[model samples]
Target: MKRFSFIALAKLPIGLQWAVLAGGGGLAGYALHQTGLPAALLLGPLAVAICMGVAGTRIRVPRLMFRSGQGIVGLMVAKSVTLGVLLALSEDWYLMLLVTAITLLISAGVGLGLACFSSIPADASAWGTAPGAASAMIAMAEENGSDGRLVACMQYVRVVCVVMLGAWISHLFVGAGDTHLPPIAAELPFTWIGLGMSLAIAFLGALSGNLLPAGALLTTVILGSALQLTGWLDITLNGTLVTLAYGVIGSYIGLRFDRATVKHVARLIPVIVAANVVLILLCSALAWPLSYLFGKDFLSVFLATSPGGLDAMAIIAVETGSDASFVVALQTLRLIGVVLTGSFCAHLIMKWNARVSR
Candidate 1:
């Protein structure tokens, strides 16, 4: 079995190989999802990333793993923009605007905290640790002088913590009506053509060779979701695919934490962990008030407060049986908010850093 798996992995293109590993693990995860695996989502991505790290150390693959999983995020964001979701929010624009502002402020605060407390050079830590998109934050960190290792570690560690914690928090605060999330819709009976086409579009998106700075997974996620929404194509991304996405993302993150940064991480784990805890607590507290003000339920506030990316948060929202429309609505608004304000805040942190340096 090991030999066969190795041979299978060796025969595939580098990109597909990574995808298979990630996606394959996701599938395996899906199979066992019912068992309530701890950190089920992260397992696949970590596995693939570890494999890729081993392989890349041995032989380089140009834009292999990076491009393959990058687009998954964008595809996830597009899922939040169905016509119904758009129209409903159009009527509630004022409340969304408020929530967006609040979310941005909290994100900025957390970024600033990381800058001040950790040994991470302030600017890169601030931007790279920004908790929206890993690739986007890392790119911004690089451009802004953030340590990629610090930024990647901080961003992903927070993601892992936030997802697990968010769910626990939801359960914590759910009150009487809070219920465990329904099972994900099982993979629609398989069709080779459909699967091929779904992957084909993702591959084509990668082939576009555009450097979508935020990340290709997000780009492809957006494109693929758009296609799905428009009825031009349909994909029931199986657990394997989903797990693969998580694993690629997770492993990419773990690999980013080479020895030096790992050391920093160990020393600063308490600080980073505290930051995540504080952010989550504050966000959840803020969510309650906002939910009342917006005339939405607490879960909506929870979704808003939950700092996972639009895609990851959205999936959790859906998985936990939160109102899909509300989840999508809140996440979409937050995504737009982050894109517009994240850089400005990073700049602000940088300016502050320079002042301190002087």
Candidate 2:
């Protein structure tokens, strides 16, 4: 008998290998969902995929599928955008600027410390430690000549930590949290027209690769938000679509892992996790003052300022019954801030590192 079931199946046809992944991921996702963990479906597939990758699974998710998944997630997040959210952003532009600047500086400082003290490169460190849409950060990192695979790993670790902490805080403070989320399909079983439009838009967004890093995602978000605000677009993303997206993303990242990558990053994981924890704590601390100043509940504000991606934070916010709009607005604001500043920050850090070495 093979030492591991995965090892025994290593020589199977790639199609069968993928079948194994799908079966394992589905079972794991269902189990985790039943446990009510935050980002359960995504995390469950991720857990299995990581194990498969570590076992030297030869299959890899196609880049197109991964990009499509990103596009879908972008649309999902765009569903949160509304006219009132835009007005709120405009009204509190200065406050938004202040918090965004503070968050970036703190994150950059942490990245710099990690780069100076660790084996990771300066650009990779900056992108890895950045607080923004995790996928966006990873894409930008790759575009800027950083080790994107490592950045993806870093971002995932931070996301898991942030989600767990946010969920715990939400459950602890608010007994029987109050969520006002309407059913995704309160009107019909499903909107085929809406779903088709969404897919068409997402496919169009994926074509934005030449214009932007993570273009598939950001473009879809921008286009979807605009159309949604105009009442001309109906995004009909359901659990199955969402699960497929998550699976694609999870598998893509997981397949990037291998023995060499694992060994290279093994020692770095601990410090990377610590840095993420520190950033989360800092963001939470900022959230407290912002909560009082804005006359909002701490959970809402805390979630608003969290370092996780908009998708994961969205899950936590809905679960905790936090003020969904406020969280989305701030999260959207921060994502823009991070995306805008990501390249400049990486360049600055690289320069500093070069100077230090000389």
Candidate 3:
């Protein structure tokens, strides 16, 4: 009966498909939130969407909506990255750079190991495991004649693992206590005009950010951070709007997991998953020493170093009451490092794999 019901649900009209996602995702999110899990809004929708996707539902969140979600998240991150955060980040610039460089090396080593031992192709392996800026990695992979689809698959798979494990880690280290949503009306202090301006900025940022990979989010972050720092604008997003953004972003990724991609990569799934887990574990291990080095909570530093989606990690950082500013700064720095050095790293990994196999 359950299987039959799901089959029927899969064949629903596009509108009904959307309705199911919204309702199911919301209920799931609420249930998880009640359980005090951080990032319930994101993880719940992601899980539901993935099921809908694997079951072959024709559900697609519009591109603009996805970008808007990113924009909203970008602004959220911007609000967190204040002047004190800047000074702190600057003080530890060398450490951050060192960590990023080490992360890239570890990612490359993982890719090389995969290429040499696994059934996955070398090009795919090389690009799939790039540690930060997934969009940039995918684009760069394709530009360099790597398999873009597989690269995307590998990137998102790692992202899913990172988020799930990061959540669990947060639960263990920080304790998931009191996850109920704050009252929307009292969530933030903003005048009507401030809210209007915030939305305008998000909309415009998403509209104008298509020129680069993850540009909408990055652009919004830059714009919002500048305006907020200059005291020219105040961000005023309520809980409802932010939750909607989270739902859209999570749904966007979930809807992309069509049956075709899954079946095509089924044979490679084990190794891919193993690789992601290894990368995550290694990163988490680094977080411990770094936490002590930086005098921050383990969760804050862990979230900063976790090779997850920036938006997802940011949400977790905020929910757990960690140092969100530190998380954002380090993540932004690592993303920049990854984009700048992806090609050279890919080449090096590929070459090492070739030599080892020979």
Candidate 4:
């Protein structure tokens, strides 16, 4: 029997190399899942990709792969958005809007402070800290003449921090230890037609997302929800597909963390981490009052208010048996709000930076 050789694989074409990396990442993610760590699939692939990236691996995940992953996650999230959830959200529209406004302000303030104090540009910092979809923000930052690479670093670092901290907090407060994982497709009542329709929606959503702001994931979620909420379709994705989505997303993000970025932001890492911690604490505090007003537990509100990846937060909500619908709704609302207003806010910060520099 011949032994497998990574060295030989590395000599292959970049596309094939990436495929191999993805397979290895999926296996690693599965192994990590066995350890009961929250978001293990995401964390494992992310860690592996980061290590490979830092080691100077030239394999790259295409933009399509990332967008598809976002679509899959978006569809998964949309499953939580029922008519009941919509009605509840309508009743608290004012409160949810207020919370979204406050969170945006906090993000803007942190970004401005970073721009004023650090060497990072104002536009990059603003979009990086906007609390919007990480991929969307990065793209917007680049389009607006900011350093997309640095913005990606800031956004993803905060994402990692928010996810890990949110998981720990949820575990501590909600005691998710006793809760079993949700059943996969085999146990669920799902049809091939439903799966086919869902895939069609995801593909069309990805194409439409090119025209919409933060479109890829948001579009998928909206389309999926529209179908499900209308009782026209019910789609249940299998555990394997969800895990694959996680692997692609995690690997895509992790591969962006190369040596040059790490070295460039060495001094700024501490400041960025500090800013993220302060933002989370401030948001958590603000969530307390809303929890009472909404008749939800503190943990649920905190996760809802958290500036993290939407899919990761939603997953935590489901696993912890918290209000998944509420969490997903608020997160989705805030994400859209931020994406819509991000450009104007970034302009303001840039102007402010100019004035302060004078």
Best by TM-score: 3
Which tens-of-lDDT digit does each residue in 240-334 have in candidate 1? Answer: 56545555555555455444555656777777777777776776677777777767777766776676544455555555555555665566566
The per-model lDDT (C-alpha) reads: 0.59, 0.75, 0.83, 0.78
Return the number of clashes found in candidate 1.
26
Every model's Cα RMSD, please?
6.4, 3.5, 1.9, 3.5
Ranked by lDDT, the better of candidates 3 and 4 is 3
- Runs of candidate 4 with Cα error greater than 4 angstroms are 1-20, 176-187, 354-358
Which candidate leads in lDDT? 3
- Give lDDT tens digits, candidate 4, residues 213-278: 546677887788888888987866777777777788788888887767877787788888887887
- Write one digit per residue (lDDT tens) for candidate 2, span 1-358: 6365656566788898899888988888778666555455666677777788777778888777877877876776677777876776577768867888888898988888878878888888999988887767888888877887789878877876886687667656754324222224343357789989999988888788446655676688789989988899887867677778777766665666655577668888898889899888988899879987777789888988988656556655654556666776677777788888889988888888778778
Return the candidate ranking by TM-score, descending: 3, 4, 2, 1
**By TM-score, is 3 or 4 better?**
3
Q: Which of candidates 1 and 4 is the stronger one according to lDDT? A: 4
- Candidate 4 — worst ten consecutive residues by lDDT sum? 176-185
**Per-residue lDDT for 245 in model 2?**
77
Ordering by lDDT: 3, 4, 2, 1
Candidate 3, residues 53-138, lDDT tens digits: the string is 88888778888998899888777777776888888878988898888888877888888888999978888898898878677788
* Clash-forming residue pairs, model 2: none
